[model samples]
Target: MGEVRLYMFQTGTLKCKYHDIYLNQGEGRDWEIPVPFYVVDHPRGLIVIDGGTPVECATDPHGHWGATADFFVPVLDEKDGCVAQMQAAGLDTSRVTHVVLSHLHLDHVGAVGRFPGARHVVQRTEMDYARSPDWFQVGAYIQSDINRAGVDWFFLEDSWGDFYDLLGDGTITLIRSPGHTVGHQSILVKTAHQNVLLAVDAADTLDHWEEKALPGALHSAVDAVRSVRKLRAVQENTGALVVAGHDPEQWAAMKRAPAYY
Candidate 1:
């Protein structure tokens, strides 16, 4: 097996209402959370996980994020662009061969169009739902950000099993843990030493993982709960480090780009 190197970074912070993140608690309080993304180096190629916030969000949040920007505003600049971050870290952004999205949310799928010819992977369920999401979810999946006409798309299905070895090297694996969206998923990376699980929106914040608190917006609360529980069991069994999707506290303490897990 090839050695794997994982890099974690944040594009910026999103200002969202507390109630919107942690179920029914902190209804009126606004909070800022990190928009974290990961890049991994494997013998196969460079793979980017959840393409940080789109570069456009840095320039004009409203233009790219639409009305949703009113509620969940991104505080960013051009420096936070996926390419810029990689370049700064001495990584060749142009060498990125694949981009795996945890889900189709605008924030996670922002890099879909950035890497030309790079294979973009997402759950088949997510691709289908993105075609015509419930009226309430349209803003979360911005058409401008996801309308990548020329990029290669590799849609995955959960029918295959619980974990899909993305490269057949067992270095990067995808876990289908829907809840935040119809087909949301998380990533599990096995390095030489330990396992690291990026519990994307499935566990948006540590609060969700620790207390089983429901995230505010959901297609199905039942599914959300089940996904979190599944993630918990996976963590317990694998002894993997569970990184919350947008945890403010966790993001601050963790190392950013130029650092690897």
Candidate 2:
């Protein structure tokens, strides 16, 4: 039973339509969901999972995102950003050891370039798809962020299993639960007292996880559904408290950074 420390950050709040997250639900209404990123303080390394929207989006969402800004507008305070949040909480950014992106989505990969010294990790399939996404997915990847120069990356092409034990310590496990994107993944973080699952976009909210709604975005709907079930099994097996990607209610209840979990 190896354990580590987990710290969560609310980089900003994303404003989008209800349909943007769930399938055929909450149309015509606007939704404000939290954009959260995480940092794990482990004996082996300081790991980061899923950086939020680009910090530049705080000042100029339009200029930073271009036309895609029309669909997803993020509202963030000047102090909002993964790097800024860590600094504010008294954590050293230079100590960031490994940055693992859940996928190369606009929101998820925004901070990759900020951690040049850290080893960035992602699935090979995700990297490939992000390079030349279909028309539907083109707007999701901001090439400048994911394809940033001088950033060291380590791709995992695990063919035999879903779980990759990062650091070989069993404290942080990367789970391949794709569907929201072709290579989207989730994370399983074990702290001293609990197993916390960062179900990044695999199950965007409680609605998706409960099958009350499906994700509006998908590379494969079939795989999306399967991945939700797979996450459920992980939750059951580890007794993990599952934290969905951008659920407003869940985010509200969570203890933000400076309060480790």
Q: State the C-alpha lDDT per candidate.
A: 0.86, 0.87
Q: Kindly list the per-residue Cα lDDT of model 1 for residues 152-213, writing each as its tens digit.
A: 88989767877888988777889998878888889999877678999989988887888657
lDDT string, candidate 2, 84-121, tens digits = 88899988888888999999988887669787589998
lDDT of 2 at 34: 88
Error of 2 at 18 (Å): 0.5
Which one is best on lDDT?
2
- lDDT score of residue 36 within candidate 2: 92
TM-score of each: 0.96, 0.96
